[model samples]
Target: MKPQLANRVHTLTPSTTLAITAKAKDLKEQGIDVIGLGAGEPDYNTPQNILDAALKSMNEGKTKYTPAGGLPALKKAVIDKLQRDQELSYEPSEILVGIGAKHVLYTFFQVFLNELDEVIIPIPYWVSYPEQVKLAGGVPVYIEGTAKQQYKITAQQIKSAITDKTRAIILNSPSNPSGMIYSETELQEIALVCKEANIWIISDEIYEKLIYGDAQHVSIAQVSDDAKERTIIINGVSKSHSMTGWRIGYAAGNKQIIKAMTDLASHSTSNPATTSQYAAIEAYTGTQDAVEEMRAAFESRLEIIFPKVTAIPGFKVLKPQGAFYLLPDVSEAARMTGYVSVDAFVEAILTEANVAVIPGSGFGAPSTIRLSYATSLDLLEAAVARIDSFVRSKWQEDLL
Candidate 1:
């Protein structure tokens, strides 16, 4: 007889982004020409200064276990960053660093949730939020954010979702998939609701540095003192510094909660990689020129591709204020092509056109599809053209 796996393991959904990326990779390995728009990482290389720091750490024999939470220097860097960027203050004791922002979130859910306790997650969320909550024995309650609202949930929706079982709410601005940012006014209103309900607020600000236009990244903790006390700020250099492989991310909030997370890390994983932690220190403290350069590249790509994508027949897109993704509603295209679902349309494009884009079903927005413009502009243009051709061919066939 096969050994039984834990029941919790069966409940988790594999990441659709990774699955699609892997499929594209497999086709490419088989010598097929595939343009993969499914990856979430920036195509930019890590900055030279950060790379130098990692090498220096290794040369100086600094590649050992750090404190389970993080090195003191890195924690200080995080504290300084919060003060400088968000105008929010946190002591070293109130901070805990983990393998990555995703790991920090996983650790967060593990530490904060009790069985049957509920966390209110906004719809069209990053794919991991609900799975992590479920893995941590928490029930995930979802609130939908309509397209008309720029995919942001209003304070009243949050208030309405709250029940006796609701323990927390997850907020992601400059959000993944949609790339919509919450305004200061919106955040202040939501903060008021959360404060009144006495609920914990998990603010994932990993993409905080990638915002474009006049939109600014504001931390919920920055709204007020009461908000700060209840809000846990999750951030890292993976996105900002193009250091995804380095796996360094962190959380800053109430000292008790931070301590609890640190203790959990002590047993599960000792610390974030020591060399990577050193790299992160340099990333936070060094010249930010590379960060701006990458941001400029992404903004430029978005500017060039947004119009072309919208011009595709039966497609509509919202101009993203931050992050590097474009979520275009493809329901019209799907219907016109005779596909019953958006996923079928996505699969057809991948198989017929050799262009890979993730279906929005995983993001809780089934009418849309997500394409990451993190790659080169040329490739993004080619992918969109291929998609256009594929859709047009389908329409031509239907006409017959």
Candidate 2:
């Protein structure tokens, strides 16, 4: 059916995260005891007040469609959040809310990208970049950042990748699959390059408040005047406030792009849910306590998980600065098991050890595997031990 589908659709694959999740579920239903580390959601429940706000909205008959741009209050809240948190200012008209960060991005690519308009994508990117570019009829120029640099590309790398056809560059921080956050200094370098080239930046800061330790999450728009004008800042409460299922996300940007996306969203889903909008209002306007509390827990997990994984034979882990996932280089671990490489190692671990992880190939970086410590510390500790033994007993004894 997919082969007979639209040419653009056929060119893309199913989402890597969801695919691994489905595989894990199939194993679980078959009575396998799998500790799934492949999920991206926070383990915490949505804070009680935020949930109560949604329930109250429903009781008030707020279930109807909202304006495509968003309810006046939610859009205004998005505006306030940008100014308050990112130190970037925008008119309420410049805000557009949608289903999630994913929707905001997909619609932006569809609306503005034309045939062969190149989008500069940093490699080891979130898995959806190339697929979305293809769907939007744009070319994705991927620039690979090696593991040595903590999977972050430099200003020189960006300068090298641009061409006249390049339209925008996607930037995700407190990055998924890597948890690498760009420092203020690092973002300044990239911003200077983009300003020199007059390039647009799609800054994905969905994990804005989930950073661990000393990681400072800086919005590219906040770097300078030029960056703020050309950048579309994507943010949401999915990670920060534990609101993934509520499906609220937004973009604060230049008026023109915001208008185009609002128009596109007007016909597609109309608006994000009314109750979700109300819930998001609480998410943004509520106390700062929940944000800090969640960050503390995630930091603790990172403190515990990274050392153990790196101690395993053939394992290489770059300390993740933000987000909740650590990408452990498992190339040698794979060879030790006699299965050629990582994909095999991942399969064996999932089936035999009942531990589910995402293969690095899914994230555009083979030989490295992604492990999310967003679950209980007990599960994380147990998962790493099982993996270490599986590798050391079967392969490298001395490293363990």
lDDT of each: 0.93, 0.87
What TM-score against the true fold does each predicted structure earn?
0.98, 0.96
Q: What TM-score would candidate 1 get against the native?
A: 0.98
Cα lDDT of candidate 2 equals 0.87
Regions of candidate 1 where Cα sits further than 4 Å from its true position: 396-400
Model 2 lDDT at residue 60: 88
Give per-residue CA lDDT, model 1, range 121-206, as digits (tens): 99889999999999999999999888898999999999999999999999999999899999889999999999889999999999
State the lDDT of candidate 2 residue by residue for 244-282, as single tens digits: 898999988889999999999999988998998999999
Predictions: Cα RMSD each:
1.4, 1.9
Maximum-TM-score candidate: 1
- Model 1 per-residue lDDT at 49: 98
lDDT of 1 at 76: 97
